[model samples]
Target: MLPKFPMSRQCPYHPPAGYAALKKEGPLARVRLYDGRTAWAVTGYAETRQLLVDPRLSSDRSRPDFPVLVPRMAAAKLVALVGMDPPEHDVQRRMLIPSFTVKRVNSLRPAIRRIVVERIEALLDGGRREADLVPEFALPVPSTVICELLGVPYGDHEFFEEQTRRMLMATSTADEAAAAGGALNRYFDELIETKLAEPGEGLLDELIVDRLGPGELTRLELASIAMFLLVAGHETTANMIGLSVLTLLEHPEQLARLRADERVAAGAVEELLRFLSVADELQRVAAADIEIGGQVIRAGDAVYLPNAAANRAPEVFPEPDTLDVGRGTRHHLAFGYGIHQCIGQNLARAELEIALYELAVRLPGLRLAEPVEQLGTKPGGSVQGILRLPVVW
Candidate 1:
């Protein structure tokens, strides 16, 4: 019997129960997708890493054969770097690399620290004994930071946030997703034109005055990149912040360890990332016939690399089920691997470290207001994360 693709997880902190059987079957196995299409699902640590970096694989979503995990994803266009293959991918990535360098990300540290403090203060000022951390703190820090970075007006965040939420939700219909995408594209079109006329002090302005003026990039291309940054920049890290707090609270010992010694905060972030590989699957299509681990992925075949399973592979992480804040998790695929790895990873790491550290210091008595199983999770999507994390201190 063929396994089903995009299996649902029994718990947010772990992969779907079916993943164990799939891993036991082998590194690569055939699975049926939601659309009744058969594709290869790579479930092993080594195979996932190998194929992610393999030139024979393609990230172009424009390909007719590319795997569609959800109905909405099928309507997606290949305008952003995540969907573009190299040469074009290389050129586009290089243009934004300077903004995310270690030094550049570090320069933003003061601002990120300030955001965290202000959010925490607001939560305290409310004087509420119990609150949902998602909207109260987790979502705001990253949203504000991305708004500042992109020169997007924070007052307009509600519009883009609603559109992006609709676009990412698995329950959203193809038409709904397309409508959301269209709204974002049109919004950016107007914003890009404004930036061109009166360049501001944000990244969009830099790209306009430097890259666009030089004719190195088209207005549409610049707009697409801005849209990509706006969505990808906040969504992933915001989810991480909420989930990380919940995970640490669940394991009081680990939380206490972090609170006691702030020095281990960095290591704690890596462990949290490995433990909760939020992106359940990475989609790719074979550009050419490729053979690995006694399986042949023919040219034009769809491939699904489930990093959640790979991160838990026992061969790489002994007793992978347990959460250890001091564990060496540098090799985890949480940020992906190879050329398509997350471009904003440095910025993400900084935000997480500061946010988690502040939470530990300010809310020493923090605990879950509801049972772990009762917490709300975003349903039927590639990104696995909590919709609301209620807590009290």
Candidate 2:
């Protein structure tokens, strides 16, 4: 049984400083998880890429030795997205991929642009010269987009937003995250029933009634997909928007360069991803005994491949710590490499490009409302997000 401790400390990847330590330790080191098991943490760029690409590394957490972020129950639900080994993961991912394709997501650009404009207008109208970019701008963009994509009614997102926030907040205890997960599952169960009754063009509608036909996904599977989109699609982009916004505001010179040339925004987004790297590590268990970096990972051993660390590795990126947006270093693995590379990469790119470009262009004279360290933050999750990035224009 796992020891009872705060979930905040149990997170295998927390402070970026850990990566510096791992660099000195030759790429891999042991760390404890919420389940109280010590597992190998991979930080080197080459090793991280190998671990993610290796067929021998299983994303399944069902193994007894799997060192998970939350408790067994919560981790099980969280891993539903590309978390399982081949066959099953492939099937589920295939069903979900088309909805997030560049073509489909691009169709929603009008809606996304409308959403961004409305939110910015509201923020401006509120008359607060300084506001938290997170709750006001960063959180709403992705939340609205994901809800719109999944066919979730805008009115119904209150519960989902709350539950997803709890689950994504790394500081939440295992029980807390699990409870949030359960609530989200229940919400999806009801939402799926609604989608079943009224088939629409969105992903949920097609998955249940149209694409899958009858009995393709049981009630549980339907609910699982709904919850998966809620968390997976919403939280990560929200954090990135906030981090990217803060990053640009902090470095005005780069922001000016990006504003001067729209062509540079794409490269800037990639560099920001490599620098901030909010998506952290992807965890897996060894399917069979495999050797990585001369260290043997026995079957059933848990592994964490920290993409954030690897993206900043000195070996792959020259001057890894500095944010050189125009370096044109697009080869970074901020998104996990190999088959499980994020299906929503294009959508994420579009959102980041739109958000960053619009802010730089419209919110002229934008500056930090407070000192960098003074910004409020919640810790312990896969993404390190600012709670309140106060800013002034």
Candidate 3:
């Protein structure tokens, strides 16, 4: 029998040894990481890949057997993606896919670069000699880039940034996170109203005002979609920005090489993304009893695919733990796999590439201003990232 792990544990991210332990233990094992809930953690690369693609795994939280990882209210706020089974998830996903395709994202490159350059300039002019890169550079650049892409007013950027931070803080009280989420929904509602009045050329406006008729996306659903874009797009890229810089700074030789060879920078970003595997884990409920990798999971059971653990699997990646930029690690699950793969991946790549390329070129002498251990990661960011990256160029 597998060992029983309980849900009364601390944050999953705090357990650094858990991945190593899981690897030693077995492919499929029970975990108690959620708030007193029993869940399965699947570690083998092939197993995780298979599970992610399988229709038997469900993302719906409304089911009677929903496996919750947080307080009810907070969990609801986090899993707001149209949780319907395949066809519905397929429809909503398809609707948003066009906005994040390679071509569409590439089209946004010039605008993204402009945003990066503008932010860097402002940082430099506004006393960037010593600045918290997360707030001053990493956070806002993507927040605004996504905002502009979605047609949210630049003025509301402040509101989105603040509430997003509150919602992600691991220590946030249930009420506090819920309040932040509500504030975001209210802001999006008003923004939706404005867009309906005078539809802007932005994507959100286009989706709401153009795609949907009178009552298509209910207020909650529309707000949820908007919230998804804002938080996911914002936190993921921001963390990459902060973490990539820190990684490059720590390995001066790699940083120097990247600076010397612009061609290699893109590869460096991919490798760093693979190495960091910023997203912690993914949650799914077993739609029905299914067997995989020689294990049986019953219906209503929660399964966690630790993409981080899979990324480090020796079978898929040789010397998986090492951060080698030239290894050609293209299939990393950093953006996830199969149907639920991140829709904003192309946009994220554009943003990371631009940020790394520009920062290397602009801040040639940049280095971490504090001890490595002193730097902190955001406590509760669904998309894991640095809390503050202090640097001086």
Candidate 3's TM-score: 0.91
CA RMSD, predictions in order:
1.1, 3.4, 3.0
lDDT of 1 by residue, 136-230 (tens): 98888999999998899889888998888888888787888889988998999999888777778899899998899899999889888999999
Per-residue lDDT tens digits for candidate 3, residues 1-393, read 343332111222222455666667678877774356678888888898889889999887677676655542343523445355677678678778888889998888899999999888987896558778988988888989988888877787888888876776655667888888888889888888887787788778767864566666676677788888888888778888888888878777777877887788678877877777777667788988999877899998888876777887888789876667667668888888888888888898889888887888888878888886677655422556666788887
Q: After superposition, how far is residue 337 of candidate 1 from its true place, in Å?
A: 0.5
Alpha carbon lDDT at 380, candidate 3 = 28
Evaluate model 3: give its lDDT: 0.75
lDDT tens readout by residue for model 2, 25-107: 67777777765676777878888887888999877665665556654335453466566777877878888787778888788
Clashes of 2: 2
lDDT of each: 0.88, 0.75, 0.75
Please list the residue runs of candidate 3 whose C-alpha ends up more than 4 Å from where it truly belongs after superposition: 1-15, 72-84, 126-128, 214-216
Q: What TM-score against the true fold does each predicted structure earn?
A: 0.98, 0.91, 0.91
Better of 1 and 3 by lDDT: 1
